[model samples]
Target: MKICVFGTGAIGSHLAGRLAKGGAELSVIARGSQLAAIREKGITVRAPDGELHCMPRAAADPAELGPQDAVLVTTKQTALPSVAGTIAPLLGPDTSVAFVVNGIPWWYYDSEGGPNQGTRLPQVDPGDAMRKAVGIERTLGGVVWSACTVTEPGVVEVRSPTSRLILGEPDGTVSARAQAIADILKAGGLGAKAVPDIRTELWAKLIGNLSQGPLCVLSRQDMKTTLADPAVREAALRSLNESIAIAAGLGIKLEINAEDRFARSVNTAHKPSILQDLEAGRPMEVAAIFDLPLLLARQAGVETPTLDLCVALARQTAAAAGLYQA
Candidate 1:
């Protein structure tokens, strides 16, 4: 399989390396210092246990890489618009694009039902650049739980104990293409699963993102350090409860209760991607992780006072840093 990882930063570097290890024809779309470093050192992945190195074709522009069978986008949500114009060179008639990032996806409502079906969220998708460039027909649902960071340009470190990727189709069916992608990832020692009902799976992961992303952003600390304070813990639980309510209103099921979810977060010492972005002065994913849910809550007629408070401040933080967009 010819797979190209667009926005090959921390998560992209790790995934691109794994795909190379799995013997796929892997390429990376990168720019700036990271691109130059990869051109010199190839793609390097330093996990907690070991390192994997591969010299995939690296290019600053998508035209150089041409078309591919699959394109995995690992960039943060806020960077999506900035890169959408450059994404087309990696697409073909049968190319599958999987968004393996965090929070609500730009194409979330593509196959969703109910009153909000086919809705366009300005905060997440903004001007609908991604929706226009990568249409829902070739779009696949993807969720990745690999904790990774680019320690430096062209250097990636896997931060978590286990790395996994979950994939599904928009209409809730596990297609042959999805299974093929999963098998490739698993071959690289990354656990990968193709499941039905991707929307529910997305919501399940989102519950955690909505709960901890903002607190970590505001506290300027990782989940463990932030949740250590009793007040922070209460606020975390409140945000989580409100997310549960919003998901329920949207008819998405929750496997575990909110309390257990918050406890699980409290045990994690990792800083969310949003916090990482803020500390690095990168754009924040305020819309996907927080703002869009608030929109959903309002549409559902759900009360989310505490959620509203955090969302407001989070938006301001993104704006103050010049990361939040209209």
Candidate 2:
């Protein structure tokens, strides 16, 4: 299968290396120094067990790569507007686009069957931009569990021993291509699965994100340092609980306990992506990652006092620094 990884940053580069290891025909859309490094020395994945080096077809322009069997988008949520039109060149008739980033996705409501069934999240996909270009029928849901950092251009360092990925169709149906993509990742020594209920898995992953993302942004520290103080731990727990309540109110059952999830993330020394964006002085994901979830809480009649306060403060801090827009 010809697979393209859009925005080949830390997670994207790691994922691209896995696909390249599986010996699939792969291409990557990267820019600047990262693109130069990939062209010179191939994309590198540094893992706990072993290091992987795979030279993929890299390009700055999506049209240069053309259509693909599948596309995995791993950039920051706010970067979507800049690359909105550029993504079209990667679409084929049956191509699937998998967004492997955090927070409520653009296609979140496509298969949502409840009180808010088929209700679109304008905050995530404002003005129908994503839906117009990449229709909901061709979209896939992705959830990834990996701790990674880009130490340098084209170099991805994996901090953990195990990383997992889950893929599913928007409507929760099993797809042959989803399983095939999962098989490819498994072959490359990653835990990849095709699931029937991607929403549950999304909320499970999101609970961790909800606790760490805003705290890290506020503390200006990685996961370990920010969750160090007993007081901070309590705050993280409160945020997690509120997120879990919101998810349950949306009719998604999160199998894991919110506190357990927060505790599990306490040891990771990696900086949350939101923190990374803040330090990099890039556009931060305020709406999709933080706001839209709270927006859903309001829509679902869920009271999220803790989450509301923290996320608002974090957004204001980012906005004050001009790293995020309202």
Candidate 3:
């Protein structure tokens, strides 16, 4: 199958290398130094398993790559508007567009069914650009468990011992298209699955982001270091409980033990991606990873006091740095 990976950052580059190694006809939409490096040296991923190197077709314009069987959008939420404007050239009649992003997706309410069905997240989508560009019929929900970073242009370092990608249809059906993409990712040595409940997977990952991301940004330290403080650890536990409560209010009860989760996170040395962006002076995912969850909590009438405080401070930090406006 032919696949195109949009936004060849850390996660995108890692997935692109896997797709190339998996023997799919692969291509990438990239820009700046990363694009030049990929065109010159392909993509190099230093993973815990081993080093992988592959050169897929690299282009700055989506039109240059044409339509594909599938397109995985690995860009941050901040870039989605621009992607929507340019992504049309890469979609075919039956092509699937999987948004393998963090936090709550913009398509969270589409096909969700019920009173909240069709609700729009203007913060994430901004004028329904993505909804119009990639219709729900061709959209897939994806969640990835990979702690990675691009050490240099076209080269990524995977810090996690294991990485996995989960894909599913928004309407909760196991479709052939989602399975095909999962198979390609698995063939490249990454653990990939096509599940029936992608939203559950999303909330599970999001709970971790909520508990760790804001604190890491405030402390300016990695998870292991920041979470080592007992006081902060307790706060994190409260945040975790509140996040789970928010999810439960949304009708998705996540079976996560706060202590057990922190026990594992306290050993992780990698910094959260939002912290990385703040340090690099790039735009952080304040709205998607932090703000949106709080918004959902308010909508569900779930109180998230600990999360509210941490997120407020983190948002201020981002805004003060001129990275985030609100």
Off by over 4 Å in 2: none
Task: Quantify all predictions' global Cα lDDT against the true fold.
Answer: 0.85, 0.87, 0.93
State every prediction's TM-score relative to the real structure: 0.95, 0.97, 0.99
Best-to-worst order by lDDT is 3, 2, 1
Greater-lDDT candidate between 2 and 3: 3
Clash counts for the predictions, in order: 0, 0, 0
Best by lDDT: 3
**Ten contiguous residues with the weakest lDDT in model 2:** 255-264
Local accuracy of candidate 3 as per-residue lDDT tens digits, 128-237: 99999998899999999999999999899999999999999999999999999988889999999999989999999999998789999999999999989999989988
Kindly list the per-residue Cα lDDT of model 2 for residues 1-326, writing each as its tens digit.
99999988888998998998887799999999999999999898999869999999999999999999999988887777656778999999989888887888888877767666688777777788888888888888999988898999989999878998899988889899899889999988889999998888898888778767998899999989998998888888898888889899889887776656777788888898878888988888888778888888898899988788889889999999998777
Write down the lDDT that model 2 would get: 0.87
**Residue-by-residue lDDT tens digits, candidate 1, 128-240:** 89888888888888988877778888988898888888999987788998889889988887888899988788888888888778778888898999999998799889988
